[model samples]
Target: MKGKNKHNKLKPIMKKSMLAALSLGIALPVAGSLPHALAGAIEPTINISRPVLNDDIYWLSHSSEQVDALPIMPSMPIGVDNNTIIIDLSTHFSSDRFTQLGAISENTNVARAYVTNDNKLVVVPYRSGKINIQLQAKNALSPEGEMIRDNIELYISKKGDLNGDDKVDSADAVQLYNYLRNMVTRRGFSYVEKNQADVDRNGEPELADMNALLSGYANQSLGAKDNSYVLTFKQVDDAPYALNGKLNGDLKVGATLTSNIEFFDPDGDTPRSMLYQWYRGSEASGEGKTEIIGATEAVYKITAAEQEKYLFLQVTPQSYSSDRPQGNPVVLRSESTVAVKQEDIVSLSPSNGSTEVKTNAPLVITYNRPVKINMNSFSSIIIRNLTSNQIEANYIFFLGNNFRANDNKVIIDNPGLKYGANYSIEVSNDAIIAADPDDNAYMQGTVVEQNGVQWTFTTQIPQ
Candidate 1:
């Protein structure tokens, strides 16, 4: 009876064991499949928030400015199941994986790109053009992750766009001028804007750049075709030469002469200043030329010393540019030889002989050309009273109080002439001298008379 009871207990225990085995077999398969499903749900993904991934990025850079670092990816979030994120640049990809990074330009002359330590892609553009950049993100969970690629089209522009409107205009030139002269506040330009300000492309935003920008703005206003804001550097300098030169004006003593010389520069350089010099030569062909002292003007006055000599002018074009400051000099000779004119009395204030003379009538004399009064012959000029046989007035006594002499005329104060009395005025030959004396003309106070009279006048008697 005891053996039968034990067998019953053993039977129950065996049934319980079989049930436990069947439950274990079903739970193991479900637990194993759960991990696979979780792995699929937790796959690594790269999220690019900045710059809108897969879109073409347009970047404009000024050639005069330097681009330090431009962030391509400012914010990049990686979603993974506690996996280490790894960022790789397309340039660093292996040969086998290059295709996965997408098409990239091999020419980086215009710009350069690189990946930052924080998985942010950065670009440095040197000039104008299009460039391509590729970025890939991977994790421990997904080693062969997808790439986030985009094309960067960089457009390089010349300097001088101070306002950064992209179009160079008069406003930009004005701004540059104000900035250079410190007429405005110290609102300095950025690296890129500064590059635009360097219109001359000399690596500096100087006065020359401002001038060039202004010129370009003017050309644009005039509807010029080649009115680009950027100035093309002149590689070689060509010296200026005279196309044609000629001298003008009367070639005589006390006359003014001018030069009409046209200059042409092969490089189209405008002269900053023109230098002029007057020379006196013996022959009209410019032989035995001698420079006239203090005759560095566009117009030269013929002097008495230059009479009977050829007058010529020499002009030199000058520029502020250091490349070529001075141009070839041009010499222009006068067409005719210089002549000296003789000094003669042009007119007298009073008639040569007249009655009814007043008591206080001054004497006046006029010359045809400029003449100088001889100080040594001051006493020789006198007004004598013929009726009284006495000298009425001496010119030396009134030399300063009532005597006045000028280029072509002289006046003497009267010293109480006798009313209704005959008077005779006599002037010494040495009293007047021509301003420009020559061997054949105005020889030592040789004054020619006008109307056959030197100077004799009658005034109203006791009006």
Candidate 2:
């Protein structure tokens, strides 16, 4: 697969020109969209149908009164003949498939399918390895039916030709090999749909299929081609903490694939002898591709194609040493065909907020994405003081990444203050940061304030 480059592109004017056509007395998904078919070389075909926001099931695309996901598929596939991109999920197997990627925020849904613009099939690979969200959540989008539709945005790449034949092959055994290569668990394909190369046809992949993976050019001689190769280490504790983080791998495609790289500080708890290496596999049982880099430039580039490949990190489990073989491999996987140039940190909350707030209610801040913060990684200061600006105190609370937010409310470990007392909580100017090696720049520390004022809902104590 020849490497393909992707940059964010936008479309809007078409909907305006077709305003008359849109108002044909019908309810529609994003009626504002106009038919746009571009006949450019290797352009991705987009199936855009903004759903009826409040009424339809979130996952289904709706016309005025009904939800229709299929109909929502890109209207144009490939060319000038009312055809810009053509999709044949049936040709590949008749089974329909779609993908989504919202690495920046679990709350944000970024889905993608093979929608077309003209006659040519558009292979759109999403470039948002991560979105600009905060490490904390603030008023995360509603999780009703809209969420399902949002999931549809998961994107695939133009270069996912696993067979090396320059096409997505259903019958070819390479898709099987690629799938196996991407597996980080024994329960292969457990989370995804079935593939043609189930080998044993048990609906689950096994070592037999793994061998098929090897047979499909399993391990090959290493060379320059491997340079673009990279491994990833994602801290998936199910909780975003480092000790519980998992390491995975993927092929580096561009500067945008930094999520796959991490600093495996051997004794990471201590910074010296820091190792920045390309990691691979799951944390439970995998290995690394190279020695850890002991440099300060947190991110390093892996000059390779953005292909669907696998990688891992190698760590000496405390149970084992160089002289002793006591540990097992910890294996993890990447967001298939997805890589990051920098850790995907969307953004912090309160990008631009009012300088002051009501003293009665404590200020609540949140992020578009999650963050991994630690004792030293934090960039700002958070403290409390008497509203008159006299008493000052540092709760000295360390908020690591992984805070969750919804309904415009974020959870702070310690509101760390006396209720009804005047306090001004300030987020450091640069308080935003990534804590875990796997965390991106999506978190921002906030400054909240409080006052002695009591709520009307609360009864006042007798003075």
Candidate 3:
């Protein structure tokens, strides 16, 4: 059979027998008796041939006598330095003869496989590392099946070693910085080089890497091309740093809650990003707390309802560097703020100790009065699989319709619960809760010790 792609040309498909050879994991001669040779005469012979690349495409082919042989392997290793290699089907057989093409990479994150319009296989590398790629071709001819196959290696460069000088010192750091700043122009680096220069490995070469390099120098620990950036410490919590600011104070009903929870890094490295979340709860112990809607600023106002309520702050500081890879951003979280007097939970969904709850039911908590929430504090509310002791829900903080400030209600979304499973929703002291800003009695409540709340129920069995 023949087929046409964007190139508008006929392509032959490989016989089914060839694809079968691939599944068997070893190349052997196609099923057929060898031609009888004349007495004392040498018999004609053929071997499986390896695929070749032309014009960035890969090509494959095999002789009739070579049907059982495996596809030829690449002559050399391939890597991020030389990732784009091709294998064109038209080279070994007519495009019309092959129907399916398959390719596999040992490490998907490091390399990818692509087929071109003209039926050529293309291998692309994404990072500075080594990966293996394999290719296979199949056709409908002969239900017995036959396949053509090939394999190749790929390699990406070390992170931060843009010049390939085998070192990640001030020279590489300066070069990367200048490149990002467009100070000069030259062309020894390839796609893999920029990836290597991305010291922070955040998919871009940025100033965070420079600052990390500088900090590393100060600590006498700058070095290496490993996937994870090496640092004297992975997070600020281990560093000799301080958290400063107006973390705790009293406020009048009409005044703003003073905010000043700041993280001080002793090495003075700039953070790639910083996050702040304020929480309010009924007790000074921070139980029954919820995130304050849009309270992400370094400071928050003390609304009327928050007048007498206790408040605390939470801050997350992050920094990026060659030592701190993208997926593993260096982060340090501050302890929860001092729990302050807050609002109360007047009603809870599933009625606390209720049983036979629906699997898809939502968890709801209603306050006695209008209340505000601290979004990040939702982490303190854990939904665990009582039988497995596994927490099944991942709380995503969003101030959508799920939360109604006017009604003083907060709804916790559950991803999914198992049928007939016993589950527990435990609210810890860290969850935030606060009264509405319009209330005049906000400051009238005495500071209370709201320990926390926990409820359990069994889900109905699935039909």
TM-score winner: 1
In candidate 2, position 211 carries an lDDT of 41
- Ordered by TM-score, highest first, the candidates read 1, 3, 2
Identify the runs in model 2 with alpha carbons over 4 angstroms from their true place. 1-312, 315-353, 369-381, 384-393, 396-408, 411-444, 447-463
- Candidate 3 lDDT over residue span 230-320, tens digit each: 1000011112111333443334332345444333332223454456677665566666766778887665656544534556566665544
Model 3 lDDT on a 0 to 1 scale: 0.45
Looking at candidate 1, the ten consecutive residues that score lowest on lDDT are 1-10
Instruction: Name the regions of candidate 3 deviating beyond 4 angstroms.
Output: 1-343, 376-381, 398-406, 427-431, 438-453
> What does the lDDT read for residue 314 in candidate 2?
33
Tell me the tens digit of each residue's lDDT in model 2 across 186-233: 333321122223333233343354343233222221111111111001
Angstrom error of the Cα, residue 106, model 2: value is 57
Pick the winner on TM-score between candidates 1 and 3: 1
The model with the greater TM-score, 1 or 2, is: 1
| Each candidate's clash count | 3, 105, 70
Q: What is the per-residue lDDT of model 1 for residues 301-405, given as tens digits with 9 covering 90 to 100?
A: 677788788888889977654567677777778877787655556666565676665666557778876776655554455787777788877666325455667
